[model samples]
Target: MMKVPKGKTVLVKGVASIKGECEVLGARLNFFECEKFVPVFCIEDCEIEINGEFRILDGSTIPESWKKLAKMDWETVFLYGGVDSGKSTLAAYLANKVGGAYVLDLDIGQADIANPGAMGYGFAKDVVSLSKVSMINGFFVGSITPQGREAKCLQGVARLWKELRRLDGRKIVDTTGWVKGRGAKEYKLAKLEIIEPDLIASFEGKPFDWKTFEVEKGYVIRRDKIDRAKARFESYQKFLRGARILELERDRINLKPDLFRGKDVTQFIESVLGV
Candidate 1:
């Protein structure tokens, strides 16, 4: 454990435990370990016991633009950025600052509130990572990336947006990093149309013709494809822990992309195998 003087800031990238009067992006910091770096500002003298890596900076590493964005009074905010552009980080920061804000996480690939193949939202009062926030509910897209499954993903977003609109509080939407090419553009625009955010915090310039706040990429660590896959696998395991299977009548439940819609192939398969 090392002593952190008041007014000093420590940027921790991995597992660590901070004790004392300190805050991370307006939220009290106690313990944090996530895929991105978290800045811990000492309100008073504190002790931080780190397990992975840390950097003691002159002051907070949080960008001034982020600070300004947090102060803005907007009912709904959408974060737009590419991979590792700090969308999730900004979402967590703004949620903590605003207090009792709803975080609608739509990054199905690296989902925080739900598994990798789903989108979810949760209430955030104070959180270092959205993954720590309990999921209120989620819509399964059945895929990690929104490549060919764009329509399903958009449908899920629209369904979730309907529910979020009923809630009476600040809402922050974090999106995926698939901001490229015509297809990606169309998908993103469709999402924006559904959400109708009051403000769009564009981290990578103006991607669309909307009211946007050009924000800079703050301190962030980029993860490779292997790292991303590992994280997703771990998330899948965590989400499936203590799981159970249930049998229900087909007529009683609705299934997406019902496989039995086509002609039955059981007899053909049996003939081919001579069973």
Candidate 2:
């Protein structure tokens, strides 16, 4: 049975997209701009408090451990979840909170920092919309979904992180909202192995069972729910407005299983673009 009681205790399992207004017992979910409460949940022994009161989780995408890490000079953070889960919003928020950091956006579609069908990496100098963060480099994933492009996505993620690791301050990987099926799970787990980030934080949805890493799930109440088409269009518009074009140097790119092992960079780019 679904959650019947609405005092504060809500037992959410499977997948439930919140349409009307809803609240979590002790979740501080005021850090997003769109419909972000939708959850693709898997309940085991997971139990939440039901105080029937409003309290602040302190508006953080990370768990309490993040606070201690924040006091340090820097760290590597990864924010991941399904669509409308506020992954991008929280990542941007933390980037600003952490003073400065290198943000690597792995969302192929509706990417916050680069054009669709690619992964972008750059340094966040200040708190701003993801589109405003100029992309220092990118790797083409060739497809919006990582079904056939799983290898490409993994390579892109590893390459981007390696290329940007030299930058000072915290490092962040803003992953896609593609946590649905078996393929998605395998792809994310594989990608995480390559990323090996210090912190593996997820938004409202936690699909993978990577218990060893112990994902930190954050909750938020999203007001707007934008689809992929709109998100992509909006992101592109932002990039076109003031983003200065920058070229990717081949030597800087680090792909373990090079997609273009025998092909030149131009050929690889053209192939990925399907041109």
Candidate 3:
């Protein structure tokens, strides 16, 4: 255990524990494995026991704008940013600050509240990470990225929002980093139309025509494609850890886009294959 002086800031990556008056983004730090380095500010003199790696920074990494954003009374706040832009970190900070806020994670590729290929929302009374929070509900988008599944992604968003609207308290929405080109622009616009959030907090400058609160991308660790794929694999393993198989009639279950919507094509397939 190491004693941290009051007003000192430390960036910890990997396994660590903190005891005494210390806060990570306005929330108390406990035993946690830092996937990326998270800034821990010593409110008072504290002891931190670390196993992985740490860096004593010059000052706190938390931005003034983030503190200001947290204090606002917006009912619904939408987060816009690219990958590694600290969107999830900001979401967790805001959730901790707002108290009892609901986080709607639409970044299906790197989902925090649900498995890959799906979106989910959870009630965050206090959270160091959204991935640890229990999912209140989820909508399957059937794909990790929103490239070709843009329509399905939007559908999932709308469906999840329908359920989210019924719940009281502030809402924080985190979206994918697919915000470029005309297609991405159109997709985001369609999403905005459905969500209509009171505030749009952007980390990637002001890309939207609508007014947005620009936020600093503080202390982010960029992950490569291999890292992302590995993360997704882990998510899949965790989600399907308790495996079970159940047989149900075809009519009892619903399939999106209904593959059998058209007429019988068994004969055509047989003819083509010469079977």
Could you give the C-alpha RMSD of every candidate to the true structure, in order shown? 8.7, 12.5, 7.9
Model 3: lDDT to the true structure: 0.84
How many residue pairs clash per model? Answer: 0, 2, 0
Off by over 4 Å in 1: 13-15, 31-36, 245-275
- Highest lDDT scorer: 1
In candidate 3, which residue pairs clash?
Answer: none
The TM-scores of all predictions, comma-separated, are 0.85, 0.57, 0.87
Q: Which one wins on TM-score?
A: 3
Model 1 TM-score, all chains together = 0.85
* Residue-pair clashes, model 2: 2
Flag regions of model 2 displaced more than 4 Å.
Answer: 1-74, 204-227, 237-275
Q: Positional deviation of 52 in candidate 2, in angstroms?
A: 34
Which lDDT tens digits does candidate 1 get at residues 123-184? 98778788888999899999889999876787788789899989999999999999989999
lDDT of 2 by residue, 51-114 (tens): 2222322222344533443454437766767776766656665676666677898888767677
Candidate 2 global lDDT: 0.59
CA lDDT, every model vs. true structure: 0.86, 0.59, 0.84
